[model samples]
Target: MTTPAQTPRSQDLDRIESELIAFLEGRTRASWDEDVDLFATGGLSSMFAMELVVHLEQTYGVSIRGGDLKLDNFRTVRTMADLVRKLTADKDTDG
Candidate 1:
């Protein structure tokens, strides 16, 4: 179940997905699906992952740390979107 506030979060997630795809496409000739394993599929590397975290933090204004930096969170495009949604929601709730 999702609330009204989560609707905007969902939109943001979609936007992030598109942006990530664009970024990936610019980096490689490979195409990625939403469920593709970013790391295992070689779509992402540790160094690029750190860059991604920085980008997400700057773009979304969400501070990801501690438990948030797990492999599961960065596994796929969909999972990354979910992580962003969670972080964004946490930030909103805290403020």
Candidate 2:
């Protein structure tokens, strides 16, 4: 069974995927696979990546810094969602 926190986290991930796919679709005029490597596919720009960092930090209320600021972590929408889950859990436990 999903806990209360798990429920919102799952929903947030779905929302994140939706938002990202919408951005990609608007920019590339093509459907995006959830698991496709965004960097490899040239689907993301440096500006967009930074925008994603800001969006994740603000939307998830979790800071992205230090060792967590890795490009590999943002390879795909699913991976970014995973990072959000991890950072959010870390914040919860720390406080």
For residues 1-95, could you state the per-residue lDDT of candidate 2 as single tens digits?
A: 87565687788788878877786788678788779999999888889898889978987788999888899888998888888888888888998
The residue-level lDDT of candidate 2 at 82 comes to 82
Q: Which stretches of candidate 1 lie over 4 Å from their true place?
A: 1-9
RMSD of 1: 4.1
TM-score of every candidate: 0.83, 0.74
**What is the per-residue lDDT of model 1 for residues 1-95, given as tens digits with 9 covering 90 to 100?**
97566576667878888887777777766888888998998889999899888987888788999999998998888898888888888888998
Scanning candidate 1 in windows of ten residues, the lowest lDDT window is 2-11
Best by TM-score: 1
lDDT of 1 at 40: 93
Clashing pairs in 2: none
